[model samples]
Target: MTINRRKFLGATVAASAALSAPMALAAGSGKPRVVVIGGGAGGATAARYIAKDSKGEIDVTLIEPTRTYYTCFFSNLYLGGFKEMDELGHSYGGLAAAGVNVIHDWAIGVDRDSKQVTLAGGAKLTYDKLVLSPGIDFVDNAVAGWDVTAQNAMPHAYKGGSQTELLKAQLAAMPEGGVFAMVAPPNPYRCPPGPYERVSMVAHYLKANNPTAKIIVADPKPKFSKMALFQEGWANNYGGMIDWVGEEFGGGNVEVDPNGMTLSIDGEVVSVDVCNVIPAMKAGKIAEIAGVTQGNWAPVNAADMSSKADADVYVLGDASQQGDMPKSGFSANSQAKVCANAIRGALTGSRVFPAKFSNTCWSLIDTDNGVKVGATYEATDEKIAKVDGFISSTGESSEVRKATYLESEGWYSGITADMFG
Candidate 1:
């Protein structure tokens, strides 16, 4: 019997709701307060779960800059013309209805000692436990001749929405036989398979309209996630259109000149009509301001996703350096559930389960042809370690590939509902 993922999600959420034993570990007087920063998968899910499971026992607030969140998970499909921009956008109304105070503002400062968060709008919120899920931000000057200012010209488009649209526009307007160059990010970035999926999407678009258009990828990492699957798809669907240069071939040594619309690899400069420069990334700025991040990412306790810098603070999603789990929306959502249960148990003496996390990243190789990689993880005392994993085989039949794509579509809907409501 085939278990539908959408139905499974509904059942899982129902089980969580029914089984929550909210033991009363009440503080002196009123309800305990929790503050969550960032509203994409991690923060929003954490806030909603805390509020919902607490059964009106705790006050929860979610601080985010945008009223609507755009997921980076399937943003590549937006470029592929398989999904519209609106499909990637979700509102916070559902979260608010679940008793989470959704504040649409940037969290600019985090005070560890005081357990307070200062917003860009000059407001302050105090929390008994603070959850930080601020996503990725590029390392400044990581790529030569590329900076925030140059992003308007070259378009990193990694953040979704406007940037995604900008990249799509560039792809549509490229001249016949024009060169499209991509400087892929290094390891430990958001969604390890994201850049390659993007290349496939762009190639799909160009193949239909401008068949002669070419794509050049200069990748810092020698091997990427799902490398074999992506390469096979590219060869089968977009043969001879993609030129992937790995680290050994000087892909690691890349410099860009946005002013001239050029990309230089291994000292060989090529004038490019359009460029997508994805720079090295680190935990978002707020994580650094919170002083929870060490090096580029924040370290967290495996049990509760609490930051090592301060037990009161928990970091999740792409901003965190948790073991085994890739920085994807699915991973973030899974981590949020574990973190939420822990926080609730701490505040109200609820029955917190052992942290068991899972993630599946689905990528579209061509229209209606998708592949995926996934794993189940358990939290060790040291880190969140992988228990088991699976990947789509290289030579799958067309029917199997199409079914996988459909499964991904089902998962997207189910996860969004789980996070938002």
Candidate 2:
């Protein structure tokens, strides 16, 4: 089923009463508090929705370390020069004005037993419900000769903000005919098509400034999302400027030398001007600290995104191991609405409705050249199952491609407004 703004609010209420869970607040307490960690698409949207819809009946506090959040969604456009850094950065002022208690602090600990969160600033906050949308953290030793300390030399521009800016600057400073290399991540990383899109954007930038510069991608996966479409776009737009090596060709067996500025792919060492190493990812440290993560990710109930380990806790976005959904911003935003509705129902004795979700991921191949893939999902007994889907065609008219790009532009504006406001 598809969900729009109106349908989201007008969900069909169930006849049964809300489930009774132990209230974290004592009787006559001012309000039942909800503590949300991470201020990205999922957490921000959930905090805003619960606060706005509850009408002062519940207290919502959002904990994020960064004061200004740079969205990972459109950050590629910034690297391609289609957008500015300011355009991708959003502030929490709007969420604060909408009644969310936005706290700029790191959530250092989550005590599920006590229903309290400890911050790095030495503050403790109690909550009736906890939401974790902390995104992804890289796995140590996932890539040879790469670690957090080497991120300065061989940067992993996976996360938003400074890392993105660093990569952009590196692209601009490439020597004439310089070699730019990227070590792609394994499966289930955030945004499956992200690294390929970055390569396209990087190629776009180099074609204009340093036409002789080249891009080489070493991917662990045999094939990625929108593989045919991305390959077609690369051939049509980038021509002979890009090369991709998959697992079948020894891309999976690779090592890097950050100090030497070289990558050894299939035992062939090549000196590189800039190396972007995106390693394997897992739920952020706080999720592991909470004791909710089974392995790398936290499993959640499809209906409400509640943690399988703890009903009082919910996990969203890339940190969640929900079935079928790609770890993308659009998916997280959709899941957040479903989670918010359930949280409000359980805490305030409001109406609870069946959960339905939808997501669309748009990628710009080049200037005004766009492609997309999306699906609608419904909650089943096992997981969030896909109902139907659509994807951009390999061969399409320029007019159609441009229209798709425009549609993506509209979506970016709409979703950001929905999230921050």
Query: 57-151 in candidate 1: lDDT tens per residue?
Result: 88999998888788888899989899999999999999999999999888888888888899989998999999999999999888988998998
Model 2 agreement with the true structure over 1-421: per-residue lDDT tens digits? 2333443333312211132222233356588899999999999999988888787678999999999999999899999999999999999999999899999999999888899999999999999999999999999999999999999898898889999999899989999999999999999899988888888899999999999999999999999999999999999988999999999999998999999999999899999999999999999999999999998999999999999999999999999988999999999998998999899888877777799898888899999998889999999878989999999999999998888888788777777778898
| Model 2 regions more than 4 Å off | 1-28
Q: Identify the leading candidate in terms of TM-score.
A: 1
lDDT of model 1, residue 282: 98
Question: Which pairs of residues have clashing backbones in candidate 1?
Answer: none
Point out where model 1 deviates above 4 Å.
Answer: 1-5
How well does each candidate superpose onto the true structure, as a TM-score? 0.98, 0.94
User: How does candidate 1 fare on TM-score?
Assistant: 0.98
